[model samples]
Target chain A: MTSGDRGIRGVDSAADDFVARRRGQASAPAAADRPGWRPTRALSRAFVVIAVASALGVLLGRVDLVILALPFIIGTAVALRSRPTALPTVTLQLGTDVGAEGGDVHARMRVANPGEVPLSTAVLRAGVSPWVRLRQGHGTYAASVGAEMGNSIVVAGRAMRWGAHFFGPVLADTYACDNLFHYETLPAEAKRVRTYPVGEPFSADEAMPRASGLGGTHRSRRPGEGGELAGVRPYQPGDRLRRIDWRVSMRARELYVNHTLSDRDAEVVLLLDVGVDAGTSGGVDGKASVLDTAVRATAAIAEHYLHRGDRVSCLEFGPRVRRLRPGTGRRHYLSTLEWLLGVRVADGVSSDTRLLRSGALPPNALVVMLTPLLDDSSLSALAGLARAGRFLVAVDTLPEHVRPEHDGVWSAHAERLWRLDRENAIGELREHGVPVVRWGGAGSLDQVLRDVTRMSASGKAMI
Target chain B: MNDSRLAQRYHQGRAWLRRTQPGAMAVRTSVYVTGFLAVVTAAAPAIGAARAAGFALVLPILPTVRPMKVWPTALIVTCVAVWALTGEHSYALAFLLGALLYTHHTSAAQAVTMRTDTYVTPEVVTGWARRTGLVLLAAAAASALVGLLPRLFGRTDAIAYGLAGLAAVVGLGGVLAWLVFRKL
Candidate 1:
């Protein structure tokens, strides 16, 4: 089977495992076994007050003391008459395991009292990830529950950023007997919901520099079977009978065949430079940082190419050097998105350049490096790939309004110098025959790709 | 060095205070104030002890730094002792103190059950109110019955009446012990 087929199968099995795990969790007991109807401090206090007051009143012949103790006796006896014998079950259910950035996620917490006695109050506190903004504002809540009934608290919130966010490990306690007796439920397991980054709209009209696969939309230069007609030529012996142009044959008084360019697919490699993040991310609606720009732009580019039947892959140029193998189709697009969510800056670890020299990258693939042009190592790597005659395009993923954060008085001058140095590096990379373009939503890489395609057509070396 | 530690504790206490919800704080403050009022009213005839107990009840109002666990019950007991020692024999005052003491106990129980940051539903508050009202009604009925005992039966010897009250108290204690130990 092809790599794409294996990737699709892997995604299917992962989805199956997720469903099975959820089923197991649902069948598990809500809380650990414990004694039922335990007395709270309040109950003990009431009993002590009642016993002591009654003893004192009788000994001292004080009717007022006896009067003071009457309420405690009545309240305690009435409260303890119908004690809850079973623990309440608490479960937190998420609406979905997957969400889009800036999309709403719904969660329901059910506090069910299965016992015959009703609960006076149940206090619930849920721990939520910072990425999720719960509409309820606070995590702690108290509500009364009836016998054999349940309280369902629906929490709806918007996902602020793209990542795996946890929703629970909810701690709950049920108080019965007028808040005299209480029982605690075991903490529920935290639920993980992955929020996928919303890719910006992107499309490229330019043809790829190199197309290798047999079936696709791009017209290849080699003469073979395809839909786009190149020209009519004198009939060759190996030409199919269907390819013969009857009108051309009659006009030329000889057998002529239609020559069509082969439609073939190309490979697109998205290289993300995660060595350093430039700006501060303000979530999905706020100002996008360097890493944010890189991730979102990679998603947009991957979607554009994958939709056109091209093999797309991702490589993180960071300390870890993570890689996603080339694949195609809708499932591969989803896999690419899942892969992007884990992108983060690896602190204290130096970037490894071994992946570039490992020959893992295909010779004919177009390498689109998404970077902030901040690090010298990344620039040198781009220059090396260009010198190696690879079809390379460097996309500037830095936010325009980003400024250096420093307490020194020379901060402004330092920032200006850094920007100038970055501009010079870009110029050097372009001089090395690497096309550097700033990342915009659509047509960002069209002119660069067109120039690369023309150079490839001429069989000229990129260096 | 002690001052730094004290400052750290002060900052932490302030943070805890800030985290408390305004609505929850209001409810807790109301319960504490009611308990203080009850203590003051019960010991009103003894002005010295009444003022001291009322001032003592103010400490638990802070919630976070309460030095005593059973402050509400202790204050009520102190007030009742003051009322008895001051030679106050008015039945009406006894009945009022009884109602206020029960109200304070029940309200304080509900208040301390939840955390300061907890958002308590109106249903919980209303249910507690309803239950407290029922208990108060029961207490009032019992008080009235005890008062009628002198009218229904002729005045008995003090010794015999005291002995009978002692037996009743012992029987109630036994019943309470059985109820508590059976579950354990």
Candidate 2:
């Protein structure tokens, strides 16, 4: 029994119902509602009034024109007819702002059916404004509503620049005007949409500071930890084989040992630019705003750092600002996800530079920013943080492929201006001694990271 | 509330609409019209023209223009066809119209059918066959009722009497639709 076919609500529950029905215990009605005498809506039936009026006018005047109007008359008459079908629930939410294409990364939405009767059908869609690219899944579903299976669907879209967007009122309808405009449809509850800001990505381009708060990285610099072995005493049972120097033992010493130090964790702070213009084209898979990229990047970096037992923090800004302080471990990761998931771009229109002041960043923290570097708001913010003597890396998610949007003669000129602005932004970042990596659409990634870091502070711009 | 009950209601609704399905109405119209012509023929040979013309209004509406299963759209076309052919009052022609209408909505083979994707999902095809089987079983009982009704009552015009048969068929059928929809 398919859950949505009055089958069952959840996939698990549908399985149970199928088993029960096969065992002669389950009983659901086999009959579906007939397509007649169904409830309809005033909006769809409004055309019926015109048809009736046409009929009345022809009857009163004895006009023979009604025959010519047969198609319209019949079409409107059909539209007026009522029909039955079930409705499902819908919901939408936006993720936090940090940096990337422009604003928030992706908009996530879900539709669920929470009703007794199986809705033979339901559809949900988002009215995404132009900008961000979808950073996630296909946002469509077709299914029935039943108990064993939840007739539910989810959608994620992008918005480049974030301000605010509203979504709601699930379009639960049974009666349709050729499946476009609907008249009768019982809604199955659930209708909500939320917004989020942009988050930043971690870039290897940023220069790491000379020191780290994490002791292990600093300890690797000490001579005693990573030096060649002098010699070793007679074998101690607890001694590691990695420390054994066999050649020294053959020369004169009984057992010599090699020395080694443990690996160190790097502290990373993703300074994301959630400005209005982040990337050239739509950011997050198309729907993702820079804010969304930043959030995801923050989560990814935080996850990466936490895995390495390193301290990681996030700073997000767009119209406004917020901070998720440096921390490590699973609890911190979850908290970070929650924080990133909840934010959207600020509405201030001006970047909040207060967060980037020298004293604001942790002492010698590794600062990696994700931005398209479209405006000073995001660029100045990162430059301020980098100037604080932190290991600064800027991950550029700007337009990698220069595509044309219009066929007008001026379009080429517009494209050049866009390229020029980007060049200026890159140059400005280089002046601050910040290591910046601009992502090419499909280039070798590790090589790019390696190349970007190989350039000394003086040889920053070869592009 | 039950599958059978729900089926009964749908049956009733469809039966009522079959006042508009081709087969039910066509069969009823055929019997009655044929008998009416017979009665008129017995009374006087000249009565045919008036009688046939008089039935024009009811012709399109009766036996559902084509057949009850053919539905609301068939009414006008069936009416026009019946009216045009009423000069002859041919049973064969009426039955043809009824077949055309019914086949328009349903057919024996999957290829000769309407509604392709939506109704023929894997799950729905299975359900449709199961439900169709039950309906055919229920229809057997309706046919039996029609066959035996004459034995219980005095002889009347077989054509006119077919109305009573059709009514019984639809009335029982309606209850069947309801029962099926509601469950037994």
- How many clashing residue pairs are found in candidate 2? 113
Question: Which candidate's lDDT is highest?
Answer: 1
Report the lDDT tens digits of candidate 2 across residue range A1-463.
0000110023233333433332242121111232222322222222332243234323332111122122223333343233223334445544543333344444434445443333333333233333333443222222333432443344344454332332222332221322212222222222222223333433333223333553433233322443433335665677777777788767865776655443444566766665543323243344343444445555666665565566777776565556787777788876676566445434466544566542446654666677767677777766765555545667775444434466789988998897788788778877776667754322313443353344422332331
lDDT of 1 by residue, A1-463 (tens): 0010110112233434533443343322323555555677677778777877778788887666777788888888888777678878889999998998899988888899998889898877776666777766466778899999999778888888777777776767788989887777776666877888886899999999899877888888888889989999999898999999999999999999999999998999999988778677767888778878888899999999999999999998877678999999999999999998778765444343575675556888899999888877788878878877788899998888677776699988987898888888899888889899999989989999998888888764843
Worst 10 residues of 2 chain A by lDDT: A1-10
Question: What lDDT is reached at residue A290 by model 2?
Answer: 42
- Model 1 chain A worst lDDT window (10 residues): A1-10
Q: Roughly what TM-score does model 2 have, to 2 decimal places?
A: 0.46
Model 1 segments more than 4 A misplaced: A1-35, A348-352, A406-408, A454-460, B1-29, B48-57, B64-91, B150-157
Please state the Cα-based DockQ of model 1 relative to the true two-chain complex.
0.53
C-alpha lDDT of all candidate models, in order: 0.77, 0.42
Off by over 4 Å in 2: A1-266, A277-300, A330-348, A357-360, A402-404, A440-463, B1-120, B126-184
Candidate 1, RMSD to the unseen true structure: 6.7
